[model samples]
Target chain A: MASIEITNARKSYGAVDVLHGIDLDIQDGEFIVLVGPSGCGKSTLLRMIAGLEEITSGDIAIGGNVVNDLDPKDRDIAMVFQSYALYPHMTVAQNMGYALTLRKTAREKVSAAIDNVAGILGLNALLQRRPKALSGGQRQRVAMGRAIVRQPQAFLFDEPLSNLDARLREQMRTEIRKLHRRLGATSVYVTHDQIEAMTMADRIVAMYDGIVQQVGTPLEIYDRPANIFVASFIGSPAMNFLSGTCQITAQGCALILDDGTSIPFLAPPNVSNGQKLTLGARPEHIDIVGNGSAPSVPATVDLIEPMGLSTLVHVTLAGKPVKIFTLARPDLAIDSTIEIAFNMDKTHIFDSETELRLPRANEPFAAETA
Target chain B: MSTPGKSRLRKTAYWGTHYLMIAAFVAFALFPLYWLLKVSVTPNDILYTEGVRMWPSRTTWDNYTFVLTQSHFPHYFMNSVIVSGFTALFTCIIAAVTGYAFSRFRFNGKIVIVALMLITQMFPLVMLIAPIFRILAPLGLTDSLTGLIIVYTAFNVPFATFLMQSFFDGIPKDLEEAAMIDGNTRFEAFRRIILPLTLPGIAATLGFVFTAAWSELLFALMLVSSESASTFPVGLLSFVSKFGVDFGQMMAAGVLALIPACAFFLLIQRYLVQGLTAGAVKG
Candidate 1:
């Protein structure tokens, strides 16, 4: 196991930059998941760490040694590609033991290592089979086994589970986590699927447009996102945003909507009156009330998607689409009017221009750090 | 399952189109070769008398016997084989290395190099034949089998490289990257992981270059003057005298020349059919 540090890393192809000065510190044995959208440079960063890509400008240190000038073989990092690039000519056992053989390890020791990894991944029976003979899940396990057999300084995975079917992806996701826990190897995984990052990582580094948006625990990113992008990108059905002006009422602060509705917010004292802000809340935090007895906004249901455990209600609010996840089977039909109330305590306020979280009452909006 | 009449009609219609198309193509391609054998077996005395006839009234192996024993057909056949064999071997080696480099690396001026190779293919071979002959004369390469091999390899390398490049391109880069991570260097990865998977491609390239070199006429005729160094295509023309053409013996030699090419393909047809990388990656 080894600690990795990426300092002010920058990647560029000619004049166009893909990664713009990224700085991250990964502790030994910590599972760090880099999550972002497509073309967000998460994979590029991981490849740079693995010595597959040259750094435009920056330093990457593995086990306290700088690896900027080192080749992939010298970097001592094993990567599981998205394509599961198994040697088509070699059987599963040969694929897994290839790295050790390159290192000129003894033949007996190489076989022993392959046996150990195969046992861990439950691939002993399929060791004699080629990559094409195995199912997708089995191939994925072989990819992982190939990486673990080397016992490299760090393991890098580049969307390795994206190719599998949904059910198999979930199963392999759990298997990867279990394998990580059992081996306690330092690892970096990149995926666009936020759910995978949330479920698998000890720490999640959210990225957008080649920049690190925020880094925190799963609950921290969910409970307190640093910006509108992280808030929307890290959740199912995403978060709802309402644009308005901060109004200081006599009792507490409130936001004055465009339609002249005042929704009170438990805001910090430093927030000046009449400041423009965007209020953010997750779908699950908002409750749909039946009648006018509670404070609510009138919305017509656009569509309802029943997910067995919960129903996703798509409704229009302030002339914009908003999705709310409700556990109750609301007797609301299509095009029917309903009242929705925000849990003010869970509401997030962002400065509209900067997209940074605004201070709410005595609650420091600084994101949770591990 | 009970509708036997409809099923039989459908089966017959499907097979009718399939077999009709196949039979038409087979007859179109094989008719000339069959005629070659027929004319080769016909005696020279009855050749004019049996003019334009599909089959001769009588057949004899006199043309074959005279060409094999009396003419320089065997020496020319040996020279053609040596030149074509060497050209195919050298061209495939150069192409594999250059093709793999083009497929895998991102070195400086890679696109320019590839563009230059493509440009080499655009020029007509006829225009360069005189210049090649002139260049080879001063070097004492003219009238030599080595000169023909060199010319054939130069003419065929660009196309063979592109052919090998496509095969190399079909292989995923991840496989080699995996090999590297497993402990082999890039070259070792190419040899162990990628080369085995590319047998079908290699066989195809060899067959293509071999046939191309075997039938090449322009360079062979221009470069070699000796009867011994002339290829079979050039040798096929020798039966033509000032008075009339020896169609019977020429066709006989032509029929004999195809035996080696056909046998070569038969030997490599297995490797050509087997997808060596079938179980290597996802479909």
Candidate 2:
């Protein structure tokens, strides 16, 4: 196991740049997930670490040794591809033992290593069958087994569970997390699925447009996103945003919407009076309350989606669509006015011009670290 | 209510025409081969007497006996085997490597090289026969089985390379990348993982080149003048002397010549039918 350091890493194809000088410090025995949308350079960063792609300008060190010029084989990293690229001609045992056999390990030792990995992956009965004979889920296990059998310095998984069905993907996600705990190996997993990153990562590095938006624990990023992009991209039924200008009064600071409605913050954020700012709130953080409630805004219900466990109520607030997730099955008619209240302590305030979150006076350093 | 019975009758009628057309094609293809066998077994004395007959009243193995023992057909058969065998082996090896490079790598002048190979196949062999003879004569390659193998290999490689390249393209590139990450070099991955999966393609190229070299007549007739270096096709022409054509013995030699190509096809038919790489990746 090792800590990987990527300093000022940049990748360009001719004149078109894909990665714009990314810097990351990964600790030993930590499971770091690089999560982003497609074409966001997450996979490129993972490939650079694995020595599969050449770095245009940067230094990447594994175990304090620079690996920028090493071949993938010499780098001593194992990767499980999204396609589960198992050799068609080789049986399950041979596929798992391929790396050790290439190192010219003793035949008995190779067999023993394969046996141990297969046992852990529940693949003992499939040792003699070729890849073509296995089902999709079984093939995914063999791909994982191939990486673990060698016990490399680190594991690189590039959307490895994307090919499986939903149930299988959920099962393998837990399995991968358990395996990481068991081996305590440094691992870098790349995926476009936010839920995967939230469930699997010890530290989630959310990226956009080839730049790291935020890097923190799952809850830390969820609670305090650094920018508008991170705030909107990190959650499902995403966080709602309302465009407005800040108004500082004798009582406290509040935001004035275009329609002349004022929504006050519990504690004023560091912002100038009459400054353009955006209010952000998660769907679950907002509540639908009875009429005549203080500090509430009236909204018209647009749509309601019941997901059995919870309900997503879509409403127009301050002339902007907002989604509110709640456990109560509110029997509200469409286009009917309902009063909604934002949980003031949990609401986020961002500068509209810079798209950077404004720090609250109570939590001075949260935005800086987020 | 009678629609079901009417549709069933229509289905039978549709299948009836399909089988009838297939039978016609089969008969058209095999009739000449059947005639060759029929003539080989007909006695030489009755060959002309039963003119235009499908089968003769009398049958004898004298033509086969005479061709095998009394003539130089055996030596010619051995010469053809040596030339075609070597040509197929050399052509497949060269085509495999060239095809792999064309499939995987991005070299500087790949398009120019491929265009040149295609240009070689565009011209008629008859136009280049004189120049080829002159070139080989100076190298002391004329009238030799080794010379015939060389020319046959050169003529067959361009097509065989294209054939092999298509096979390589059908395989996913992820398998090799996976192998490289598993500690094998690119070449080692090709050898261990890719080459085994390409057996069906190799078998196909081998069969194609073997049959092409086996039945080639123009170059064989022009390049080899000595009876010692003669291929079976040229040897069949030797039956037409100053006096007359020996149709019986010539037909017998033709029957013998079909054996190896048939056996070669039979050897590779198993691999041709197997889809070995079906489950290697997701569909």
Candidate 3:
């Protein structure tokens, strides 16, 4: 178990840049997840750290030693690929013992290591079967078993659960978290699924367009996204954004929508009056209020999705679509009008020009510093 | 109940047409080989009298006995085996390495080199025969089995390399990357991990190049004139003379030549079938 540090790392292919000046200091035994959409350089960064890819510029150090020019074998790292790249011709035991066999370890020692890992992964009966004979989830377990048998400095997982079905993905995700806790090894996981990042990471690093958007706990990123991109990316139903202008009314600060509806804020944002702004509100933070409410905006219900645990109500507010999630199964009909109120304290205000979150006057100016 | 009966009738009709088409194709392909066997067995006295009959009234083993006991066909068979065997071996080794590189690496001049290889296959072999003979004569290579093996290997490598490359491409690149991270070098990963999975591919390449070199006539006739260096294809021409063409002896030798190629295919039929199906699915 060791800390991995990346400093000013940039990756480019000729004129096309993929990762632009990334710097991350991961602590020992930390489970950091690099989360983003596809083509966001998260997988590329993980490959670079594993030495499968060469760093275009800057340095990466593993356990206080520079590993930029070292081969992947010298770096002492293990990776589980999205395809579960087990040796198809080799049986499960052979695949799990391959690293030790390559090191010329004693035969008994290698078998012992494989036995221990197989036991942990419940793969004892599968030891004699080839990879093609195993199910998808079993192959995944064999891939992970192959990694842990070596006990490398760190484990790099590139969307290891993406190939499994949903039920199996959920099961493997919990198993991976438990394995990380038991082993206490520094692990870097990459995935485009934000929910996986939210559920599995010790610290989530949200990225977009080859840039690190935010790095913090899952709840922190969900509560205080650094910009419009992060805010829209981190949530499940996604945060709703409405383009409007700030108005300093007698009731304090209110946003005047393009359709001429006023949505009052609990406190004024650090923006000039009449300046353009974007208001962000999560689905769970909005409530379906009755008509004639003071701080509510009238909306026409468009769709209703009942999820058994919760109901999602899609409505058009001031001519812009917004989703509201509630535990109550509201008996609402489509095309019916309702008034929805935003939880003002939980809502976010962004400068439309810079697309960055603006700190509220009452709150400390520490939200967007990440 | 009626649906089941109707589906059963449809199933029988479907399979009937399927087997009929396959049986027709088999009969069409095997008719010539049957004729060869029939002519090889016919006695010399009745061959002309038989007048294109499918089977003779009386068959004799005299041609087979005479070819085996009195002719140089056995020596020619041995020479052909050595040349084809060595050609298949050398071609597969070179093709595997070149194919792996073509499948995996993106080095300088990759496209240009691949295009040059492709262009080599476009030319007729006749255009190069004179130059090849001239080049080999000075090097003491002409009139020797070694020269034939070299030429056959060179000609077969490009196609074999493409075949091997497609097989290599069907394998996931992540397997080798994982092996490298698991403490083996790249070459070690290729040798231990990838090579085992490509056995079917290697078998297919060997079988293809073997049958090709075994039956090649143009180069064998043009290159080797010595009786000791002659392959069976060139040796078969010995049955011809100004006096008359010995059809019985020639057909006997032809039947003898088919044995080795048939046995070779039978030995590798498992891997060949597997490799073809795997390649088809991947493609």
Candidate 4:
């Protein structure tokens, strides 16, 4: 395994730039995922690293060797495409052994390598079948197995699981994670699915508008998002943002909502009074409150979504929709009035102009530095 | 349930009309060919006696034996085969490369080049024959099989290229990229991976071009005057003289010429039937 470094890399098609100057230093054997919505250039960045695309500017070094002008085969990278891109005419064994065959490896060694990967992927019985005859999950396994059989310097996966059904995607996600554990090869995976990034990545690189929005461990990105984009893009059901103004009231720094409701937030000492700010909160942190214990706000339940393990209450607050997730299912009907409390300790405050998350002076929580 | 009888009558009427239409068209198409075969087998003595008859009163193999041994039909058959074979092979190779380029590449002037090729097809072949004969006469190209082959190849390539291009366009580009990353150069990928998948297209182009060249009479008649280089379509004219026409020998030669075209189709029908690129992509 080798460490890969992309320093100030940029990509453009003629004049329309798809990737801005991106600098990422991947550690040896690190599984980094580039996650973003479609057209955000995550796949473009991965293709640049794989040598499938030309770098418009800057340097990419793999194993301490610069490879900007090298072809994909010379770069020693393996990629599993979203379509699985298996040779339809070839049997599964031939598909897995293709790279070795190109390198003129010994016949027995090629067979042995294929058998090893197929055994690991549980593809022993389907070895002789062509790609058209295989199921979606099986074709995906063959695509992955093709990458593993060669043991390339690094693996590049371009949304390899996007074509699978949800249940199979979940199953294959664990299999990929476990395979990474066994191989310990440097891998760069690209996907638009944040759940896949959260579940499978050692470090998730969130991208938007061809720019790297944030790069950190999944927990770090989830807990200490750098900006409003990161905060909203990282979580399931997304974080809710309420436009408000900051006021240093008698009860520390408080955010006054548009509907004249105040929620307390622990702001740093640098924040001035009457500063415009936005309050951000995850739905799971907002709890349904009984009267008279904490600050209570009235909301109407617009809809309820039961996810078997937890129930999501969709409520309208301040003329905007807000979803609140809770384990306790309340006997509430649509359009019924309810009271909920925001968790003061876990709320996020952002400057309205900059949209940068303002770090709080907490005791142990790691605050993001701009 | 009482309407079952009426539904059965309606169904029979619908199918009966379909069969009647199909039968009429088949008879219209096959009657001329039937007359050719009938005349070839009828004994020469009974030609006038069985005049305008659908079937011969007496059948004989004398015409087949006489044409095979006494006439120059064998030599004409060989010349036709050589011309058609060479034309098909040359046209297919050039068309495959040009078609693949047109399908995949985004080079400058690509649209202009395609438009120019399509423009070539719009000109009538007869109008170009005079200029072609003038061009070929000075270079000693007229009255040569090579000249015929070249003309046939030139005329067939544009349509064949378009035919092959659509098939190549249907194949996904991802397959070749996968091959390139598997350690093969782009040309190697085209050869080993893509070329195999395009066999159906190649076979179809070959068959189309071959039959076209095999039956082309205008260019062959204008370009080749030597008896050695005359193609079968021109050779079929020799059976016509100022005296009475030799119907039996001409029909026998016509039947003999169908063999090669039939054999060519038979050879390529496997790839043509399989639609070799079927499972190459998701669609």
lDDT of each: 0.89, 0.92, 0.91, 0.89
Candidate 1 per-residue lDDT, tens place, A14-117, comes to: 99999999999999999999999999999999989977789999999999999998878888899999988988778999889888887889999999999988
**lDDT: the better of candidates 1 and 4:** 1
Best by TM-score: 3
Please give me the DockQ of candidate 2 compared with the native complex. 0.67
Query: Ten consecutive residues with minimal summed lDDT in candidate 2 chain A?
Result: A361-370
Rank order (by TM-score, best first): 3, 1, 4, 2
TM-score, B chain, candidate 2? 0.97
Off by over 4 Å in 2: A242-276, A294-300, A316-321, A335-337, A367-370, B1-17, B51-54, B241-244
Clashing pairs in 4: none
lDDT of 1 by residue, B175-226 (tens): 8887766666789889988888888898899999999999999889988998
TM-scores for every candidate against the unseen true structure: 0.95, 0.91, 0.96, 0.92
Q: Flag the better candidate by TM-score, 2 or 4.
A: 4
Provide the global lDDT of candidate 2 against the true structure.
0.92
Model 2 per-residue lDDT tens digits across residues A1-370 = 8899999999998898999989999999999999988999999999999887899999999989999998889988899999998998889999999999999999999999999999999999999999989999999999999999999999999999999999999999999999999999999999988889999999999888888888998887888898898889888989999989888889988889999989888544457888998999999999999988888999999999999999999999878999999999999999999999999989998889989887677873573242
Q: Residues B1-283, candidate 4: write the lDDT tens digits.
A: 6599999999999999999999999999998888888888988889887668778878998888988899888898899999999999999999999999999888999989889989999999899999999998998889999999998999899999999999889788888888888898888988988998899899999999999999999999988888898988998999999998888889988888888999999999998987655545443
> Model 3: residues >4 Å from true position, as ranges?
A267-269, A362-370, B1-3, B275-283
Point out the higher-scoring one by TM-score: 1 or 4: 1
Q: How displaced is residue B18 in candidate 2, in Å? A: 4.0
Q: With candidate 2 superimposed using the best TM-score fit, by how many Å does residue B115's alpha carbon deviate from the native? A: 2.6
